[model samples]
Target: MSFYTSLNGLKNAQTDLGVISNNIANAETNGFKKSTVAFSDIIAGSAFTNPKLMLGIGATVEAINQNFAQGPVEQTGAALDLVVNGDGFFTTRSAISGDTLYTRNGAFEVDDNGYILRGGNRLQAFPTDAAGVVSGNTLQSVQVPPTNASGAQFAGVAVGKNGVITASYADGTNVAVGKIALATFLSPGGLRQEGSANWSATGLSGTATYGEPDSGFYGGILSGALERSNVDLSEEMVGLITAQRNFQANAKAIDTATQISQTIINLRT
Candidate 1:
């Protein structure tokens, strides 16, 4: 029984170490959020046993929760590099899966077809009228339309703080292409991580609530900037040290228990 309890402690310590190591590894990953391990004790007792005499068998992992605290924002001087100044995630559609994903990583680039992309995923936004007003709740892929026969060349693209995307032409004509859509959740920690700093809404997170940036509680977009990873190296290092000590202590306890068992066997012999 002692050995099993010690073994459980060892396993839990290893799990903590792995989580801390992952956080340290992704410290430089943009838009990365760190995770913390939670443990719950396993109480062993029969219904007839005295409540005060219940034995704690061991601990089990209860959860691994993500920390969604805001990370630092850095200026990248790239027009497509964006950061949410408050709260919200940029919505995107995966080309391969066709599943809607959300992310804080605003690093984006335009393809030859004039579609704004993050990897194979296309950025999603609300369609806008000629006056730049949001038209409806439906989301469309953000893109720069091809130059027309009128000879107006594609000049530049701009993303406003309010999440509006505008395309400029050499002919000095500007068009409101779309309003970038932001999604907020009732429980952000319940979101499922899809890697590449992307996340998908889960039943636990509830359905996404779409809104324009800089309006209401939605965060404003910061163009030419990006959000850094939220991992703190110093904090992770301390946690690593603590987990290592716990592992060592549990291992020693197991060794001591084995020695006691061997001595008892010798006495019986």
Candidate 2:
């Protein structure tokens, strides 16, 4: 029984090490959030057992909780690089799965087709009129308007702090293309990580509440910048050391238990 308990401890220590290693590995990944391991102790006795005599079997992993604290923002000077200054995530549509995903990674670029893209996914936004008024609640891909038929050449595009997108023409005319949409959840930490800094809403997170940036509880967009990974190397290093020590202690316990069993077997012989 003691041997099994020590083995469980070893397994838990190994799990902790793996989680810490992953956090350390993604320290430089943009918009990466760190995760912490939760644990629960197991008792071998039932409720009828004496309270003071109940034996602790081992520890079990409860859940891995995500840390959603804001990461540091870095200025990249790239037009499409963006960061949320408060709370909220940029909504996007996955190209392969066609599922709606949310991400904090604001690194985006306009494709030759004039569609704003994050990787292969299309950034989602609300349509706007020429005067920048939001047209409706419907969400659509953010796109740059093509050159006007009157011969005005497509010049460039700009995004406002409020997430409004505007396209400019060589004729000095500007048209409101769309307003980028941001999504907030009741429990941000409950969102599921979909890798590549993207997340999907889960029942624990509740349905997404969409809104424009810089309005209501949504965060304002910071163009030409990006949010860095929230992993702290020093903190992770300390956790790594602690987990290693735990692993070693459990290994020792197992060895001691084996020696005691061997001695008893020799006595019986």
Candidate 3:
């Protein structure tokens, strides 16, 4: 019993170590969120068993909760580099399946076809009217207008505080591309993590409510900057040390239990 209990403890520590290591590895990744391991104690008991005599079997991992706290902003001076100052996620779409994805990574680039993209995924925004006005409650791939019909020069991109993106031509004329819509969930923590710093909506997360930045529940957009990873190296290092100690202690406990069992077996023989 002691051996199995200690083995379980070791496995739980190993799981925690994996989570901490991942956080440390992504410490410099943009828009990365840190994760923490939660645990639950396992007790050996039956429905008819007395509570006073119930013994703890071991510990098990409950969940790996991710921390979505706002990371510090770094000024990159690049026009397309963006960050939200409050609560909201940038809406993006997978080019292959057109599946909607959300992320805090506002780093974007304009493709040769004038479509704004991140890792080949099109960034989504509300469509704009001819008067350079953004129409609400709709989403489309963000497109940058050419400075000229010839498509020779790159148009200047400007994102406003309210999430409106405008394309400035060389002729000093500004065309409203669209308003980059932000998505907010009732429970952001329930959002499922996808690779490449993206998250997908889940039933637990509820439906995402799309809105303009700085309006109602959405966050204000920060242009010319990016959100850094939320991982704290110091905290992660401390956690790693704790996990290592726990693993060692459990191993030692298992060895002690094994030796005691052997001694009892020899005495009986």
* Clash totals, every prediction: 0, 0, 0
Instruction: Give the alpha-carbon lDDT of every model.
Output: 0.92, 0.92, 0.89
**Worst 10-residue stretch by lDDT in candidate 2?**
142-151
Candidates 1 and 3: which is better by lDDT?
Answer: 1
Least accurate stretch of 10 residues (summed lDDT) in model 3? 146-155
lDDT of 3: 0.89
Clashes of 2: 0
Please provide, for model 1 over 100-197, each residue's C-alpha lDDT reduced to its tens digit, 9 standing for 90 to 100: 99999999988998999897899999999866998998999998887733679888888999999888888888888899999999999999998999
Estimated TM-score for each candidate: 0.97, 0.96, 0.95
lDDT by residue (80-158, candidate 2, tens digit) is 8989899999999976788998999999998888889898899999989998899999999987867965679889877
lDDT of 3 by residue, 1-269 (tens): 89889999999999999999999999988998999999999987789999999989898899889889999999998888999889999999988998999999999988988998899889999888744577667799998866645454554888888888888776666678888889989988889999889999999899999988888868899999999999989999999999999999999999999899999999999
RMSD of 3: 1.8
Off by over 4 Å in 1: 148-150
Q: What is the lDDT of residue 10 in candidate 3?
A: 91
For model 2, what is the alpha-carbon lDDT of residue 198?
Answer: 95
Clashing pairs in 2: none
